[model samples]
Target chain A: MKSLLQNLARWLVPVCFIAFSFSEEPYQLKLAMSWGSDFPVFSESPKRMAERVAKMSNGRLTIDVIGSEEHGRPLDVFDMVRNGEYDLGHSASYYWKGKVPNTLFFTTMPFGMLPLEQYAWLEHGGGQALMDEVYQPLGLLSLPGGNSGSQMGGWFQKRIKNTESLNGLKMRVPGFAGEVLSELGVVPTNIPATDLYEAMSRNVIQAAEFVGPSTDFNLKLHLAAQFYYTGWHEPGAELQFLINDEVYQSLPADLQAILKAAMRASAYDTYVHSVDVSAQAWADMRRQFPTIRVKDFPDEVMSELRRVNERKLVEFADDNDQARRIIESQLGYQAMMRNWTLLSDYSYLESIGR
Target chain B: MKSLLQNLARWLVPVCFIAFSFSEEPYQLKLAMSWGSDFPVFSESPKRMAERVAKMSNGRLTIDVIGSEEHGRPLDVFDMVRNGEYDLGHSASYYWKGKVPNTLFFTTMPFGMLPLEQYAWLEHGGGQALMDEVYQPLGLLSLPGGNSGSQMGGWFQKRIKNTESLNGLKMRVPGFAGEVLSELGVVPTNIPATDLYEAMSRNVIQAAEFVGPSTDFNLKLHLAAQFYYTGWHEPGAELQFLINDEVYQSLPADLQAILKAAMRASAYDTYVHSVDVSAQAWADMRRQFPTIRVKDFPDEVMSELRRVNERKLVEFADDNDQARRIIESQLGYQAMMRNWTLLSDYSYLESIGR
Candidate 1:
């Protein structure tokens, strides 16, 4: 009986305990990033997530982040990941608006909830489910990757006084904000990021929108524009982690949890980190380029832009049920959350009389 | 040869690979929460942490959360956890202010940074290291647990127009805010939470400050006082996760990572969740109790309160190097980050003209 037990144990070690070998060796995953390796917050967030996953999994899981420079195509990340060319991809959701119209709402809108408010909607107010509905159908799983706190309205050579100020102005603006600007007679032109500085410097384009101060600082945008306006678009631009569903399902349950938790933590950390970086960049801009003036759109200009944005949103959602649903969810959640914001943060901030 | 190899493998499996036993079997830790089991975001956060920890560890690590009801003494958590009586503890940092004065800085403060700004400080602006200086000495590890969004100033029967309105007023406000108010001739009283609603309704105390709308909804403070004032004190109250350092060191590298990541994700989720719940509570309060008026203190009263809060901060920081260091860090970070807030969030909100 002892001999038989010993023989059985030897066989069981190879067959029933294959999981030991799997756990002992690390599982390597490919993460395709839309941002270059040198990009500050955009690139750094994924590296942090990868590092956290490796540490937490005790080397059981490893994620290699391949940047846009290495991938050779930033815009193709979504399609490549969807086609299983990569196990994962990091990019903004709105980048896929042409491919999927409803995708725009997930990133941010002309005017929408702030990052925390949007997160509340995602976690507690059906935003995640709506997101899943959009992504799961395409064999992809989308998770919040990071936030840009708030995107600056853009850099402009001249202050925007009203709708007339936008008229006949050429700008390197894109997407939904571009569409809204076009309504006010701003000529939204597409300029490669590399030429954005030249375009603005040489009067090829008089206005532009990059990201927030941290990212815009990298573009040397301060050298190009004098007026830096506050944001009306992309109030809290959230990035996404795009995973191939089949590849995601192939992971062991423990690894899935590690991946999920790592992404979530890294996403929130990224937002706070973005805020810190923005603070530094803003301070730098003030100290180095005191010539730069920070401006807000006049109430009349803002109200007109808001009116046009509302009209565009209606048209944008008119055709698709999913689009309409997402729009309604965002609208309702923002309305309700804005009240709390007014009462808590806005009230507290104004009370200080700062 | 095969039979000899089988025999060798059987012998080696038990001796050469004892790790399987440790990995296959679970390591369970005890988590003692300062809040009751039924507590909203406070208790739910730890439970979420445990669940995520369990899932990520695949049962290799388990955390059993014990609420205050089970622990019997809520305020004793910091001492008990420090004494190694519990493996972990979840409570507000300020609870230990009497024992460790510097700890009061960790939770929240009057005229301090908001939740997100404070998070930025903790993550990027050397706040965590300063926190480590305070905690590492106690043989404990304190981490960012969750944020209470913004704590409301409190409930009042009437508007606070000026310093005269504060004179001789009996209120159940506690901690640093209470100290500042007392300096302004207001009488601060200690009342048990269970008796708070009765105290306010029966005119035992004219006013009281609970948590924000979410947690305060449970206390039904609106039923006691007609005027619901916005927050000034405890701008963003952060809760803490207390871990026995030695117990933490005993965990495997993977489990440690899992633990840290789980806590972080849960902390952020709690803040967002708190926001959602607060929105619901505020909406409910508006619809059900239309008589409850929301007000901010007059600018004169606010400036006076701010002056006293700043004065008390200087006094609070005196004599303690760590306390002074923490205060200087907060004040400086707040001053810098407040610019970003005004340019981004505050500016955008104002542009909406809502």
Candidate 2:
């Protein structure tokens, strides 16, 4: 009897193995983001990304995404994801300045570097290594996302008469920009997502900043402010992607390549959205919100601010070695890119003006 | 003299106004993030949010914090902020899945969904609206930034003879219960930082998973097996902050409240970093790496996969609206989430898993 049972077990295992080997498991994936469908990040990028990745993987893996509002509030995303509540999430960095100060360098700085320069530093410099160092402690890895090519100055409710006007002014700003504003005597503030519209509409703040015209138009800034500013401070900005450390390490190398390709698609989408939508959004705002006023910053104002920006850099370098290193690297790159820009993009614009 | 002065006056009038108004130019803002920061989303409970917000706001309205790795790779952050870049950026969102496919949801998904129920529903429900809705044509808004909760099952080296055979497999694992491996097949692959020494030894990997102690000790698997298996769809994920659009609309009344006292401070230094270095990071992974083996999956493995999981709601609903609602909501959310996930995250995971 025992011999017969053993023989049966061996055959059963082998038979099952042969049958299962020929089949594949149904696969599915999940993605989480803090923003809603209206947000350009996911609408323009993630959706397309899902389709491309699926095709590349031959349907072996499938994905599903949940927006921030659908999952949790914007702030809850990090914890939810870390806790394994969501497979993926889309978010920002400054929101967590309390935990890692160094992270600020990657996000943005007051009079820091421009988008192109920042990208150079991140890809070639030790930025990725440094970032991993911080995240490793938490079992996470990171990747690059999208980039907004420079941004316009924020909207204004009142015009300035002099530098003195900046004193005691309440402003909504983040990162290094806030520090720069502080130097000019402006008080900076930070608020959550839901409350922004209410605060701006209710007069809780004197000045505020969001993104570019496309985004601003969506938020209906035209109804609240009178003046639109130019883009001199933030020439460009990049987005990012994060991963759980253990999970990332487990992925096959080829899969990693596919992921990179998908991300590139998303980035392209964001870029195109910004370019295609900004002009139209602005035009619409002009027609719908006639009260809105658009204008550029005076060259003199830009020049003086640029001087202050230099001073701020010196101050930052004085305290931290990393800051000094970053500044030096950034400036060096800027010098190199200066000629590149002048010869490439700038020349075309100049000729058009003529 | 009057005629000559009139000519000078015309040009001087506009130049003087620009120069004088330069002081009043809208303040620039930049938001940043790091994986380790303690933020409003992932750090302390909501009860503690007020105090932190108060400190940063100094009695004014506070900036909202969605600090974590919700956006993209921590390294790419600088790019997002530099170009007027992103006014704010979170830590890392699946390391740029938006730009990379397979990697997109890996930051958070794998098994998908855990941490706290409250957070899970938030993401699966309308919470995404709070962040995504606010960021549109412009390139900005807030995002998830906190998380460190549930995780994936981990990888294994050897094929399982049965569900119980998950034992004795070699595997690489981190966080939570990496300590419990004695009863399981795992040999445990404990590699050190950077070097991941034990894993480099490549002794096993027959079957492994360390996130749960069962896989940790059993997989001592990194040393023993050739196959690695795990259920960890998502290990500890995090939220990220996104801020490009809001930073642009600096003039809206409600927008101004977006940046203020304690909240801003909470988002930056205090809240952002703490979450990354949670207690889980303090555990060691060295003891398990010595004797793991690797393994592979056999044919006809598990049955009732897609059909079972896909119809899970119908089976579990039990005629209750609430039950149906839960399943329906999950399905609905998954439907939306899948559109993008399939295109990017799913394919990436599969490509690598293969």
C-alpha lDDT of residue A138 in model 1: 97
Off by over 4 Å in 2: A1-29, A76-87, A110-121, A124-130, A133-137, A191-202, A287-291, A298-320, B1-354
Q: What share of the true interface contacts does each candidate keep?
A: 0.66, 0.00
In angstroms and one decimal each, the interface RMSD of every candidate reads: 4.7, 33.7
| Residue A307, model 2: Cα distance from true site in angstroms | 5.4
Q: What lDDT does candidate 1 reach at residue B88? A: 94
Question: CA lDDT of each candidate?
Answer: 0.88, 0.47
For all predicted structures, in order, the TM-scores are 0.95, 0.45
Candidate 1, residues B1-354, lDDT tens digits: the string is: 655655555555553344444334578899899889998878999999999999998888899999888989899999999998999999989989899878888988888899999999998899999989999999999998998898888999877888899999999988888888998888999898778899988898898988877867778888888988888888888999999999999988888989999999999998898888889999988888999888888888888888998888778789677888899998999999999998998888988774
Candidate 2 lDDT, A207-244, residue by residue in tens: 77777765776676666778766554555555555555
**Weakest 10 consecutive residues of candidate 2 chain A by summed lDDT:** A345-354
Q: Ten residues in a row with the worst lDDT in model 1 chain A? A: A15-24
- Per-residue error for B306 in candidate 2, Å, reads 63
Looking at candidate 1 chain B, the ten consecutive residues that score lowest on lDDT are B15-24
Q: DockQ, per-model, please? A: 0.52, 0.01
